[model samples]
Target: MSIAEERIDRLHTLAKQAVAAREFDRSREYVRLARRIAERNRCGLPREFKRFSCPRCDVYLRPGVNARVRTQDGHVVVTCDCGELKRYPYQS
Candidate 1:
């Protein structure tokens, strides 16, 4: 993977660890920083990492805690606690 991709992957892993430890703010910081780095490098974030945050609020989402996920109409719909909704197309 490219340097930017590697950095993003590392950040996502750290974010997951932070969220698991109930450190949501730390997770958010990690996500934000990762996103900034990706943007700076003109690289898109992988789908795995994108699933961890709300596009609008930019906050890390923990399913069953701060977010709800549902698959509908061939899409994955993510609803954040802040009431932001995001939908990603499903392949199957």
Candidate 2:
């Protein structure tokens, strides 16, 4: 992987860890940094990273904590505490 990709992955891990430790602001900072790096390098964020972050609030989401997860008819819905809703389609 490229250096930027590696750094993004590392930041993803750090963000998860920070959230797990209840250091929310630190996790948000990590998410923002990773996004800035991706934008500067002209690359997309990883699927997992994108799924776990809130686009509106820049918060790392942990289901049952800051996020609510529900499965609808054709898609999975993730509702962030900031009231941002993301729907991802799935085949079941």
Candidate 3:
């Protein structure tokens, strides 16, 4: 893994911890920082970390809490708390 990927992994872990602690704002900050780092390095976030955030609002998503997750029509649809829907296709 590249340095950027490593940083992204660490950030995602921190984000999850903050969200679990009910510190939504702090989680968002971690997400924003991870985004900046990825942008600067021209690398995308790891696939496992991609679905846990709202790109538009920078919210850390917790299914059944602040987000809705559904598998439909061969896609995974993630609806953020802000009502923004993001869809990702099933690889297989």
Winning model by lDDT: 2
Q: Which stretches of candidate 3 lie over 4 Å from their true place?
A: none
Error of 1 at 77 (Å): 1.7
- Candidate 1: regions farther than 4 A off: none
Worst 10 residues of 2 by lDDT: 57-66
- After superposition on all CA atoms, what RMSD does each candidate show versus the true structure? 1.6, 0.6, 1.8
Give the least accurate 10-residue stretch of model 3, judged by summed lDDT. 46-55
Q: Estimated TM-score per prediction?
A: 0.85, 0.97, 0.86
* Displacement of the residue 23 alpha carbon in candidate 3, Å: 0.9
Which candidate has the highest TM-score of all? Answer: 2
lDDT of residue 62 for candidate 2: 89
Error of model 1, residue 55, in angstroms: 1.4
Model 3 over residues 39-65: C-alpha lDDT tens digits?
Answer: 999999877677788988897899887
Instruction: Write the residue-wise lDDT of candidate 2 on 1-92 in tens digits.
Output: 99999999999999999989889999999999999999999999999999999999998998988899999999999999899999999998
* Candidate 1: C-alpha lDDT: 0.86
